[model samples]
Target: GAGVSQSPSNKVTEKGKDVELRCDPISGHTALYWYRQSLGQGLEFLIYFQGNSAPDKSGLPSDRFSAERTGGSVSTLTIQRTQQEDSAVYLCASSREGGAHYEQYFGPGTRLTVT
Candidate 1:
């Protein structure tokens, strides 16, 4: 399918280990976003990338979490020193543009478990 997709649908890592999650957005989409959904919690924004503009990292929980979009297409989110608290579903979404008016297409997400 040409829709947004994430790799390693499920990831299990030991505490203190680093993990990387990947997301592939639909072609031609100029806006990409990363979010996290923890148990019983609402979706938490993580980052946003729009074309060649500087990515918005304000939503990232901490310095341990970082992301990048190469060639404005594929995106990767890296978590350094994984912790149990970081266990959650990492979601990726893409839109035609970086605006609230544009609808975003979401991927199935990558579930991360730190134990």
Candidate 2:
């Protein structure tokens, strides 16, 4: 009954701090995704989770960025040693299933600011 939702609509953090962003996908959706949008850039795929399979993390920028989806529902994206370059809108999306055929529903991204 709900759409994808991300937490702390806005986050302001220092350059070296760590932050954990949360997302709750629509119930029963078997596929979830994480993306980041930098100023003037297109959405960057960060990760993907489908059902109980191992997540696709090839899109993650670096070792500092990591994510996890627990019980095929809620997901958390953890950014370690945040950097100024990391300041961007973190978006979460979910679909009934994974692949090019399924439509993804997006959330009002969490805006992260590294000061």
Candidate 3:
């Protein structure tokens, strides 16, 4: 499906390393989201971007985690000084406008393993 796509499907980094994850949403979708999933845990919302509005970044766990959307199509999530606890599946999702009620399509996550 041409829904959402993520790069570097798997990543391995040292505890202090930094990693950048990427997401590409569907052609016309207006909402993009990022989530993190630990083993055996549910998806934790990280950030959200809807159209040209200010992004909802309250869900980000720490200042070290940040994301940016360019041209409303591609998004990049950068994790600085990655720690062992930061090892998780980084998932990206996108949906058509209508707020949270609309169904979102998820991308295959980037599995980050911090050693």
Clashes of each: 0, 0, 0
Q: What's the lDDT of the predicted structure labeled candidate 2? A: 0.96
lDDT of 1 by residue, 4-115 (tens): 9999899999999999999999999999999999988999999999999999999999999999999999999999999999999999999999998999999999999999
Residue 40 in candidate 1 has what lDDT? 88
> Per-prediction TM-score, please?
0.98, 0.98, 0.97
Relative to the true structure, candidate 2 reaches a TM of: 0.98
Show the lowest summed lDDT stretch of 10 residues, model 1: 1-10
Candidate with the larger lDDT of 1 and 3: 1
Local accuracy of candidate 3 as per-residue lDDT tens digits, 2-54: 76899999999999988999999998999999999999999999999999989
Estimate the TM-score for candidate 3: 0.97
Error of 3 at 1 (Å): 5.9
lDDT per model vs. reference: 0.96, 0.96, 0.94
Query: Against the true structure, candidate 3 has what lDDT?
Result: 0.94
